[model samples]
Target: MKYVNEAYDFVNHAWSKGKIKKLIAPLEGLAYCTTVKGFKEVGLGVQPEESNYFNFFYPKGRFHDSLYGDDFPAEDLVSDCICEAVKQYIEGANSEFQVPFVRILIDLMSNPRFTYLRDGETEKKYVHVIPDDDNAYLLALRGEFLAKFHFGNKSDADDEYRAEFTSEEIDEMRKMSDLAIDWSKVNYESA
Candidate 1:
């Protein structure tokens, strides 16, 4: 498909520019959001008018219709193309980097908090916070989570969603969350 070719071109150009490292976080985030949170589609676009950086878009619902009009590819098609593109990139990555990248992906996949969003919402009612007893605590926690991770800002939050985990577990979740940011831009020629 044309979208598949375009995705491959985008990834290959990133590889050539020595900027693929910047894509690691965004790609993993896309994968996590789709496979884990049930997002319909995710895309990488270079916004020259804005930051000139590649941004990942996983629109909540009909948002894509307004953004891309009727010409946008099917959701499943785009998802498959993204998966294929990521696979090809990982396969072609340097061995040293590949090992650590795979490790990070594995850790991320194993962490339930990495896929905290439900039905495209990360707010109070949508997020699955445990021990739903303390309303004030839940509101504060949700606010912190959204502010730090959702609003493109970074800040610490108490893990009151459940019984607190060990230090190591918390560290792993923090690392993955930190890596979940906007994709970095790349130079690619569309064929």
Candidate 2:
């Protein structure tokens, strides 16, 4: 929800056919935090060849691996933690919940619930949009018309809605995120 306002700004310009620039400053911070959190959650360097069972991407720039099949650490692959957070949030739930970080924030900000709630509504639905950054956007309903956007980055930048994981996996991700957020806060305070 922190990026909700910015998301709305981007959406306005996107719909109005205005120039939408990447908000790199906020993204960098979020990415760093997200990377740190993910590292803590799974313990990086612990497994260079382990099966991640999770997929991650670099939101800032493009990087490539020399080997085709070797599994690289997800953190090393991406710089945008917010992007990753978006991914984890909707990784496995309803196929309708997949999307990019930007659009989701915009929808949540534009709508009232301040989360993803379409004002005075009751029921869940999926909203999809293709962001300027070449990422697909999808949102899942939370409350009455209240939906949450989770990020999913692909090579072609295809803006398609698909169920990435099962409902149980989505729930597990939610629980993991709760811990990650608290971990981030504690570390921030200590710093």
Candidate 3:
């Protein structure tokens, strides 16, 4: 499928309508993406000349430098939390592929408990990542969940961070692509 267009549509829909949702950009093939994020807006910028590439931007504001430093807030996401099932597929991905895949992540606050999940042993430890109002229970760490999910380690060590998931993890992740972006009514390309 046209995963590139799917990735673009996912972020575009999020900005246009402000309908917060969960989007998991796949890393199976060589993907071309700017970056990805969750919860917040990624500033504003003009579209790129290349139809294969897209970069969204947020307005200049308080968190401009940190969040909007790039055309869009570059989360450097690998998309789809790595389930324990398939942790080998992405083992050699970095050396083999350099495509930029992505996913949005936010540390869901735990005070209210309503927005957070605190039921199981595993669920209670990490910060709950609902991703949207739908309450899709994706767990995140108080620190960098992406690093933990991607590399199986939260440390910033280059080798550790670049570590890949098992083959089963990669297969499961491929099937787990979920970017609910609908451009049914809008002329997305022109807009």
RMSD of 3: 24.1
| Weakest 10 consecutive residues of candidate 2 by summed lDDT | 182-191
Q: 1 or 3, which is superior by lDDT?
A: 1
Q: What is the C-alpha lDDT profile of model 2 across 25-85, one tens digit per residue?
A: 4544432333222111211112222222222222222222312323343333333234343
Runs off by more than 4 Å, candidate 2:
1-22, 38-52, 55-101, 104-191
- Which candidate should be chosen as best, given lDDT against the real structure? 1
What's the TM-score of every candidate structure?
0.20, 0.20, 0.14
lDDT, residue 108, model 2 = 33
Q: For candidate 3, write residues 1-191 as lDDT tens digits.
A: 23223333333334522222222224322122442222223222222223223223222211122222234222222122221101222232345653222221122111121121122212112111232322222211212122123212334443222222233433443355462222132111100
Prediction 3 global C-alpha lDDT: 0.25
Candidate 3 weakest lDDT stretch, 10 residues: 182-191
Please say which candidate is ahead in TM-score: 2 or 3.
2
**Mind giving the per-residue lDDT tens digits that candidate 1 earns over 40-106?**
2322221112212121233442112222222233343334545454555557576654544445445
How many clashes in each candidate? 1, 16, 16
